[model samples]
Target: MRIALFVTCLNDALFPQAGIATVTVLERLGHTVAFPAAQSCCGQMHANTGYAAPARQLERLTEDAFAGQDAIVSPSGSCVAHLRAHTALPVYELSELLVDVLGVTDVGATFPHRVTYHPTCHGLRMLRLGDRPTALLRAVRGLDLVDLPEPEQCCGFGGTFALKNAAVSGAMLADKCASAASTGAEYLAAADNSCLAHIGGGLARHPGAPKPIHYAEILAATGGIRE
Candidate 1:
């Protein structure tokens, strides 16, 4: 399958490795991944921040960027959920594409680490991606998948929400960081880097907190950590 990767703005700029790891995992599964150079932000930030006009424009731009493709996949569940709601494009979150569309779970990945997954708000509530990510994680050879207390709670990284409601966001993030740290996992994995960034920022202030990593990186691993 020729899949067009919509490396969202955040991943394209700050977390390029997540996009690369996504491509690595897909290619390792015998599928070709194409990155549409014209692809840019999915306007999730704009829309969520009450900038309707700009959000619509970015949505149109995204529609044009991936005009024609067998399928479109993005590493960020938040971005995918926004596009799915605004456009008719056939976009799927990585887990949705892998477990639902591609009909595979393992993806031949091997990551030996104690890890816990935090279901992002978009992936958990909007896309309803239940057990798909964990199913894939469980298949990884030598991976110890631990349970996160209150896994469904939002990590307080609702894009602009974190900035606008800094106090509330920080409070929520504190609870989330505590929950993730209590898992006794070396890594805290999530489908969306936006949340990981927020949770990771909060976790960094403490010692011995599990490192935040995108699940795609975990899936892309081959008995060794990528980067």
Candidate 2:
């Protein structure tokens, strides 16, 4: 199966490893991955900030980016959710495509560390990816997946929400960081790096805090090495 990766703007700019890992994992599963370079922001930031016209324009541009792909997959559930509501094209989050479309969860990965998953607001509520990430993590050889104390809680990274409401966002992130720390997990994992960036920022302030890693990086791991 050939899959086109809708590498979102943020991933392209800051989290390219996630996109690379998505391609690696898909190739490991015997699927070809294509990068649609024409893709840009899905207008999520513009739409969320009340710029309707620009958002619509980006929607059209995004549609044109992967016009002919049979399958569109993104590592970001947030971006996928935003597009899924507007596009007629099929868009699947990494876990959704891997589990639902491909009918496989284990991507031949192994990470021997205790880890907890933070289900971002978009992935949790918008995409309703309940247990899909967890299920995939469970299938990873030698991985010990721990339950997040409050898995449903947001990491407070609602795009510009962190910038607009810094204090509130920081407080919420504090709570999330504490929860992840209590799990005794060495790694804090999530589907969205936007959330991980927020949570990981808080974790960075303290000594010996768990590092935040995207789920794709974990799934793309070969043996005990993380991408």
lDDT of 1 by residue, 136-223 (tens): 9999888999999998788887878888899999999999999999999999999998899999999999899999999999999988
Residue 6, model 1: lDDT of: 92
Q: Which ten residues in a row have the lowest lDDT in candidate 1?
A: 218-227
Return the clash pairs for model 2, or none: none
Best by lDDT: 1
Question: Residue 109 of model 2: what lDDT?
Answer: 96
CA error at residue 190 for candidate 2, angstroms:
0.3
Per-residue lDDT tens digits of candidate 2, residues 41-103? Answer: 998889888999999999999999989888899999989999999888789999999999999
Runs of candidate 2 with Cα error greater than 4 angstroms are none
Clashes of each: 0, 0
Each prediction's RMSD over C-alphas, in Å, is: 1.0, 0.9
Worst 10 residues of 2 by lDDT: 150-159
TM-score of each: 0.97, 0.98
